[model samples]
Target: MAAIAGCSGSDGGSGGSDGSSDGGDDSSSDGSSDGGGGSSYDGQELNVLTWGGYEGVSQMVEDMGASTNLKLISSDKEGFNTLQGGGASQFDVLVLDNQWAQRNAKADTIVPLRREEYPAAQEGTIIEKFNWPYQTFGFDGEQWAIAPRWGWEGMGYNDDEVELADLESEGYAAIWDGDYKAMAADAPTSVIPLVMQQIFDLDENPMAIEVSDSRLETLEETLVEMFNSVEAVHQGAAALRQAMLEGNAEIVLGVGNFELSQLAAEGFDWAKVIAPPEAGGWFWTEGLCLVNNPDLNRDLANEFINACLSPEGQRSICWDGESKGAPANTAAFDAFSEEEQKTIMMYKDKGFEAADEILSGLDQYLISPQQEQWTEIWERAKARSDL
Candidate 1:
């Protein structure tokens, strides 16, 4: 649980973290922000941050580093308050939330990845297709955060409780429908992303927004209506998996992952898909990011990223061990046995809308403390039985 966090280029004696440089580190060997940050390298002492589900990244990165000059230190923070209070910069590479990557990259909280540093960056994953023109800190012309891992955001129907037909008829509003209503009001932060997406989709959908002003009000009303109709909220994926497996939920929001996919293979019946049939699916690429330290640790950090996407590393750790998900590297995908590839496909989407475009104005992944406060909105929704 603790090991999942990387670096090395130059050797500086100054910018050492006295713990106050929470957001900034000295720049490294390349001298530019690309390979540098704080004033010191501090040996192979790597610090990492990933959400709860990705707890396995530690052993995976450590194994990858076995053949390289890097040793990464990793940690997972479940709630945003930990990041909000500061001290995030105490680590080197951060597997930040995909949405914040765009907002923070420009602010210097996380630095840009040079095209030259990653040979596999382009052909490997969704990152290459997302960027074209480089700006101050982002890849390509638009804003971006980090190279993504695999796409998610599938609709989940709890096999025991909800009927698929009813689930479809109500759309996002279904979470608050019927006996399952108890779970809807208090659902975890994960479900809010789905609600916001539904809101984003409705406001943009031709059917939902034919007229401009009045209809917009109607859409907002519907969103607020659906948002307030919940009774319970549960967060961890393990808990969700347990709920479904034990028959506590008939239908719920589904995100593609090993747990869900494996559960289905073991005879659990469930269905999932991308949201807004009119628009493409949504996915998240979980990859490495520089903490912006320019010290002896620069070169090592660069090496760490390289090893992570390496085909050999991908084959050894991806999905087979604690680390689960499709490999971002093309070679890693190819290296997957037919069975492994098929297992990952249960979650992968072929023609997802370009993340840069979908996230252009309203990227939902950007869950700042204020946005996460949707708990209040949800509580209100639960209070009303119907709009």
Candidate 2:
């Protein structure tokens, strides 16, 4: 699962903790010299920097007989900082949150898309809801990226260990019940507001968290309490899953669908993912962007992106594997069998409408001023957790 994706920085700009660029090594793209007068880049390699889970795309591209070598790699906040530092040449494609997307677009760190070039990005191919201007990424009619996956961040609990009824009834408060061993994904966007919601009955949008002496104290106090309740605080889903499997944690804070799906694939289906209606969660969409790398074969990158957005690519990602997420393409959701959709938690019996309602409750609340504040307090909270 792609959790709270962000980097410590000033408003709308990416910067590392030490204020320097860090990411993938810059390399020249070597296009395959296929025998078709160099028209086909079938055996070419496309360097990709993402938050993981693109194996589906790679597999699908291969199935189509393209034989493209997908140099799949992972990244985190550092990747964002790297992009902002003008390191876009290291990779041909990047998967980023819309907030980060805006920053890259504003900074001109990525390429503007001409939809006519990418067939998969056209109207009938992409999901209707996400095909509008700037729906994924754009600025003043200039498109830059397309959404491949979208989901919410919340709690994932062991059903056999923690009562589902308790979670539903008490909402996010169930994490602190003192009955189950808990662990949290360490991210300010999820942890801070979640603690505020569980402890203080906060009903406002989490992105608009109020910063004040009293609130800060309450947050600090609550974070300490949460830290005391849990075994460890982690920054990655795989780590959280390992903690749960090792019996160190039975309930996980900030677990999302992507993590749950991956866990399910590994025979850990005992956990149930939930986004409480009361406390709510963050709704986010991750867009796929083409890096404006001059040495890279631009045509190959476009072709790879097109193949990734195809129904097969989307299907491979949303289902048919471990890396599960809600598909950005509506048709991809339909491609799943009745049981598969239910198993993946993509559609509850009411079809996509029910899914939409659940997603509607979550707000895309990452903005300026508050982001810097959140970062500052988060560092302090982590330190306090040690105490």
Candidate 3:
């Protein structure tokens, strides 16, 4: 999402990777049997905390308005710690990035989801991805939360600024190839690894992380090199997009919101984004993890997820005819025109098929350990570079 764009892939069904569920109405083991109050509005207050820009809940409300009358109350959190502190269940649903699930689930900050209890989280293509090799929200085969949207993790460039061939062939060379400055998402402890991930992917033992004491030296070395060229670090996607729009920055190095291409219809340049061919990671597998709240509106939260997964609900969240955040509901693809679908489709193509040893190896090398050691070294590396 930051400068070097590599998004986690999600879009109802783009056909990438083997682990994700088909995401449909089929129930998963003794699922939620609780009957939600049918659409009477019942004046119930449903609270949800999520990353900024998620449309899953609001769109669902509109979709089920005729059937589930209760209105959902939602809020936004920019980071994970906010969700870890006690009081997550106060809201009916908590939508968070998937990476943080294991930690929070263990702390009991978020509760395991009873897919059988809620209709939306349990049904449709949207929530299906959670049933994987890493289901963190629930226990013994139950789900903890749902994934309403996912991002595409691959390389991107401003088409207007560079040719696609050079990008795919040169790999990071494309961004570093020119005199142009390379800007990436910062919070080195958090974002630097994404850039380094691409670098390690190009080396021996592509699946190995450079985090071990033996590997730590390698992580430091790789980051030091990357820091030499990185420019300003964006705070968030909106800020990143605005940077590109204003000419304050020229290139990014992470997941792409292909829907942004639709901005061309409104005059935003179309030539900036490019998916490098060397290999990349999907954006973090974002799922509906939670921030504990005491006033959880269990019933409406369930309805909210179900509605957003609906075809009609998915269409409601589309921006400029294409959904900015990829919808997990396979049915949502219909929301965009054929062309918009084509642009976004590349993320799934690249990720599901590309060499992922770099990303998987990184989990052990830098990101896997509970401690944030590499994050610190990365920050010092950043300080040295002044980026």
Candidate 4:
């Protein structure tokens, strides 16, 4: 079973809330003391600030003869803070959520990539859907980052306790059915968008967080009701899993298929994740971004990104055993085993066409300009639940 720690924020960026920062030994040395003498990158050190489960990509880069210094970050917010606070000088690359990647691009915290340099990240190598501007990772007519993996936020339910037919028919309305003990993951980024979708009946661009005064009021009301009705709001995957296994919660909100996969690994195959057909669920794409630093090795940074776009690098990210996601590389997805594809909920009986259709139906997670308001509303809703 995948053990979850206390959650601080949504997994939309990190993929899993259980990620912890490795505060020690940021540098990694290759066993060869000669420091890859013959390689073009010879003694160059590639500093990477990445999501917890994605540190494996650094090793792939290191194998190419560049020494790497890796630091694990738990959320995109943290990554943004680091870069904006002058931490960009410490790292050459950052694995960030698409929304934050765009924000950083606008803020000049990260530099744009030359399409000509990264052949692996060019068109035809990655899924075409992710190639759009401001949708996956492109911004201001330049590619700000290369998205390598993606996932979604949906409801996880115990099949034995809740009827699958009801979920499919009622959609998100099933959570408020009052028939099952419900719980939610304490992730405002994910939860707020989901509740917004339900209250506004927004099927398209549901992740849009900008709202007028009147619309904000309506969202607040819906969130208050949802929080109050749930049996508990779990802070970590472990708590969510424990609640379901112990029969404390029959329906879980603000989670994804990744959690369901974790449950299945524990021999509890009854756990399942579903995006309601009507409102749909939230989806997030994580990208590899180059930090904006004059001292940084641009060639080596691009090389690291190219390596990550490779089939093996994509596999290291999507099937890392700790956290699983859908690879952005078409070749990487094609290489996945039947069971691996099923586990990531990328492709099952349906082929790539079906998976692409599913991606089309979902909303991409975007950074809200009025984030303070969103956070305030979420806190108010949680307070209502406590009452």
lDDT on C-alpha atoms for all candidate structures: 0.41, 0.60, 0.44, 0.68
What's the true lDDT of residue 6 in model 1? Answer: 9
- After superposition, candidate 4 runs with Cα above 4 Å error: 1-38, 132-136, 346-354
The TM-score, computed over Cα atoms with residue i paired to residue i, of candidate 4 is 0.86
TM-score versus the correct structure, for each prediction: 0.60, 0.76, 0.67, 0.86
- Write candidate 1's Cα lDDT for 292-341 as tens digits: 54442556566556656666655543454332454545555666656555
Residue 145 displacement in candidate 4 (angstroms): 0.4
Which has the greatest lDDT? 4
Candidate 3 residues 99-134, lDDT tens each?
445555666676666656544444444434433334
Looking at candidate 1, what is the lDDT of residue 138? 55
The lDDT, on a scale of 0 to 1, for candidate 2 is 0.60
Ranking by TM-score: 4, 2, 3, 1
lDDT of each residue in 231-350, candidate 4, tens digit only: 888656667877888999998887775555556655566777777777777666778888998788998888778878888878877777544667777877766776666666622233
Q: lDDT tens digits, residues 165-248, model 2?
A: 777677766666677788887767656655565566555665665656787777776677667677777765667777777878
The residue pairs that clash in candidate 4, if any, are none
Cα miss at 275, model 2 (Å)?
1.0
Ranking by lDDT: 4, 2, 3, 1
